[model samples]
Target: MEKILTGTVVLDLTRFFSGPQATLFLAGLGAEVIKIDDPATGDPTTFSPPFAGPEGVSFHRKTQADMGIAYLKRARGKKSVGLNLKAPEGRAAFMKLVRSADVVIDNFSAGVADRLGIGYETLREANPGIVHCSLTGYGSTGPERNLKAYDLMVQAAVGMMSVTGQPDAPPAKAGSPLSDAIAGTFAATGILAALLHRNRTGEGQSVDVSMADCLFALMFDEPFDCYRSLGLPLRQGNRIMRFSPFNAYRTRDGWVVAGAATQDDWNALLRAMGREDLAENPQINSLSWRLANNATVDSLMSSWTEPLESAEVLRRLNEVKVPCSPVREIGEVMEWAQLKDRDMMMPLWNPLAQATVEAKGPGFPIKFSASKAAYDTPAPLPGQHSREVLMNLGGFSAHDVDAMARRGIISAP
Candidate 1:
């Protein structure tokens, strides 16, 4: 099937999670994503721990020359090009590629792109309709723009940590890199919007994505409104302020999550629990009343769930149409048949391991009937496609390529 973005070219200059993830989505949609990395060390995540192959850390680092899982997971379906943008020749070569490309993306500190001369203005000069997207810790013009931030830092800075975990415990970070991942997805949407604009008016613009801003959006409406209106952060772990009976309760065998967002759902839950009488209770009838007696409501729900196994609890709740599910581990999610049916768990060959690896993909997240969204290739090693890219895209001769490699302007692996 013809992919959605077959004709588009994306110059990916992102190192870590956010930018790379954005480009990964582009690549999955069939954009030709050329990942530019530093020739000396490449993406630092190449050396990140927890090796998947049999030989372990040393082999992952020195021998197999395979990407760490961190890089591999996010960087799949992109070509690799190593270039030293600080060098004059490298910058000129990058500009040449920019001219032929449709989009350029990066996740660097604010001002870093301009300092490196790869800012939107400079690239726009090379390709008038080029879409330039940048993902930063804070926005370009903010007071904290110049300050450094990673996923954890942004989470803390954005008050995410304050509202996470048990109220008694110290502030906690989300288990995943939520800020980076969401920002990357947002950056991709911005780039797509810019591409649409280019299609309409032949004008490209810069996409400025702030991780802090993205995290705030994920904070959801209730907490956001609470903070704004009540002037305090709510840290009731897993207990949503606006909803009743919305929590993960411990069942006999495991945990199950159940939520009653509407009066109907609450009545259904009560019906499932054989406690319909409680539905009309004076102190816990409406959402406001239930929230006011949250402790009692939770205890009441726990009383029903605590004696039953999670599967049984989930089955009874689901039978009554009360939204519920048993808590699943990562392993279970990876092996889920439903996700497999959706093609979310993709199998790709691991050349180094001489085996097929089941790598999870977003499965086009958005389904389109005419154009298929698919992962075309695995992530490349640093500079793996440098020679071919230079020859085809940059219009460099064999001699020019060799000279650039010798001068440390680019790497050819």
Candidate 2:
């Protein structure tokens, strides 16, 4: 299938999660993403934990020769080019590459890009059609723009932690780094939108993504509505006040979550639980009545589910077409047959290991009949394509490349 972004070129200057994740999405859609890293220390995460090497090897515990799992998961389908962006020669070479690229992404602090002289204004001057995206902790033009924000901090600042976990327990962060993931996803969306706009008008623009802002946007709407209506947004763990029996319940073997939003759905769930008496009971028959007596509703569902195995409970719920499923572990999700059939799990050859490794890709979530996303390239080694990119894309000669490498302007593989 033809890839959606077949001809696009991207210059990736992002480290860590957000920016790299965004470019991974672009790469999956067939954009050629060239990751520019510092020669001294190529992507800090490359040295971090959860490594994948030749089958049974653990890279982090053994050696730093292999890339980390975090980098491998997000750096697929990219070429690595190491250049000292702080150097004048490197800056000139980067400007030359900018002229030939469609997008440039960074996730530095607010003013760092501008200080490094690779800000949107400067890049746009070199290529007016360039879509430059800045992913930061906070937005560029705000009081908190200069503040440092990691995933947990953003979650806490944006009230995501407050509404998570049981009310009895202290506020807890989500298991995943939702803030960075969400911001990166938004960065990809914003870049795509800018690309579309550029296609029409032959003009490119800056896309500023704030992690805190993204988290705020996600947690704001409902809270803002509640605050306006009732002075505060009450935090209800697992289930919202608007619904009953809409939470995870313990089963004999594991846990399952089930919900019945409508009267019909509730009746179906009751029938599935073999509780026709409850189905016909007037006090809890309708959704509103059940919500008013939510404690009783939840207790009844718990009693029905507590004794059954998770799989059996899921089977019973599915029999009545009630929306329910077992709360799967990460391992179970990784091996899910349905997801595998849809190509969500993609394998790439780890160059260091000389072995194939599996990682999840975006799965071309929005499928097209004649077009799809691709994940053919594994993440590159540091400076893996530095010479090739300089010679081919930057139009530098062999002698010039050698001279630049010798001068600490660029790194060679």
Candidate 3:
């Protein structure tokens, strides 16, 4: 079947992580996503890199620039249009693109789109049913709305760092830019919902997503007040909330994480560890007692696991249906059999690298029984599709695109 969003058009004005990541999901679903970059500088990410190799990640250029690894990952399956929105002619061209677009997405500072004259209201004037989504660091109306933000900054602001890492250690950000990723997913969800609404009512609305807000929402998934009431420290590293025996354990070879999600699994895990006698102990079986005495549970689990090889520990747990697995390193995960079997390993060609590297991105995690997802195209050069998109979708003539290129309003190569 054709891709679900095959007929959709998106004018993408996002940069860096959060905004681009949201549009990436749309592109995978087969939207004709046109990424608008500044004709001269292009998206800032293009210049920011470790390239697929010291073509070290200003990371954008083909002859003089090495495309940043970030751009290589996030910009796949999308078109690029290098059109300046600062000039009058450029704004006119943008309006023309808007007329043909079903969605407009930007991840700029609160007033940036307004300063560029392509804010939601302006775009709505051009196309009444256009779904405009603005993804920002602190959202549009807060006191911190105009504050400069990055993924790390948002992580700190949202109090995520407070609960991350060991209580005694300096708070650490997750290995991934989680705030950016989560916000992107939320933004995409809002856009999809708005599109559904538009399909029925023929009226468009705006989606406002804040990086800090999204992360904050996730942090509250557990009851902080309740944990505090139980005299539990908010940050216990891997010691999860209200859950005992749900942490990483040291093994002879490496670390293994085993967790019991229910009483049946808890009993199974006890039997697997040759400690079935503890199952009859009332305090050990009480959920509150276990949570309060998590240290005792960990000490017990570790006593068994530490002397065993990680594989043996995992095998014993698996035999009894007690969920467990060895901790995998980054390289191990990259070569993991399961992910590869699901077609998550992808080959990305970097022209500047002059080589095809089997990079691990451009893979979507979702499966559709009917429709499809796609991730085959590489990121475009600055304005690579300027002439094509403007002429074909924006209804501009080749001569008009050429004139705009000459006037420094757009790039047409």
The lDDT for every candidate, in the order shown, is: 0.83, 0.84, 0.86
What C-alpha RMSD separates each model from the true structure? Answer: 2.3, 2.1, 2.1
Q: Work out how many backbone clashes candidate 3 has.
A: 7
Best-to-worst lDDT order? 3, 2, 1
Off by over 4 Å in 1: 56-66, 223-233, 351-354, 357-363
How big is the positional error of residue 2 in model 3, measured in Å on the Cα after superposition?
A: 0.7
lDDT-wise, the better of 1 and 2 is: 2
lDDT of 3 at 53: 39
TM-score of each: 0.94, 0.94, 0.95
Top-scoring candidate (TM-score): 3
Strongest candidate by lDDT? 3
Q: Which residue pairs show collisions in model 3? A: 46-60, 47-58, 47-59, 49-56, 49-57, 50-57, 61-65
In candidate 2, stretches whose alpha carbon ends up further than 4 angstroms from where it belongs are 55-59, 63-65, 224-233, 357-364
- Total backbone clashes of candidate 1, pairs 3 or more residues apart or in separate chains: 0
Candidate 1 residue lDDT tens string, 1-413: 89989999999999878898898889878899999988887878755754444343333444464346666677678888999998889999999999899999988889999999989889988888999998999988867788888999999998888889876779899999999899989999899999999999999999899999998877865556455575434687887777888888999998999999998998899899999898668667788878877888999999999999888898899899998877899998887888888888765444466655434445556668888787767656678899999889999999999999998889996
Looking at model 3, residue 192 earns an lDDT score of 93
Candidate 3 Cα errors over 4 Å, as ranges: 53-65, 352-354
Tell me which of candidates 1 and 3 scores higher on lDDT: 3
Q: For candidate 2, lDDT tens digit of each residue in 1-413?
A: 87999989999999999899899888888998999999887888776776666543464445434557787778788899999999989999999999999999999999999999999999989999999999998889877889998999899887788778775678899999999999999999999999999999999999999999888887776654564374333456678666677988999999999998777788888889888887657778877777667678789888988998998999989999999878899999988898888887776556677766544444545556788776778778879999998888899999999999898888896
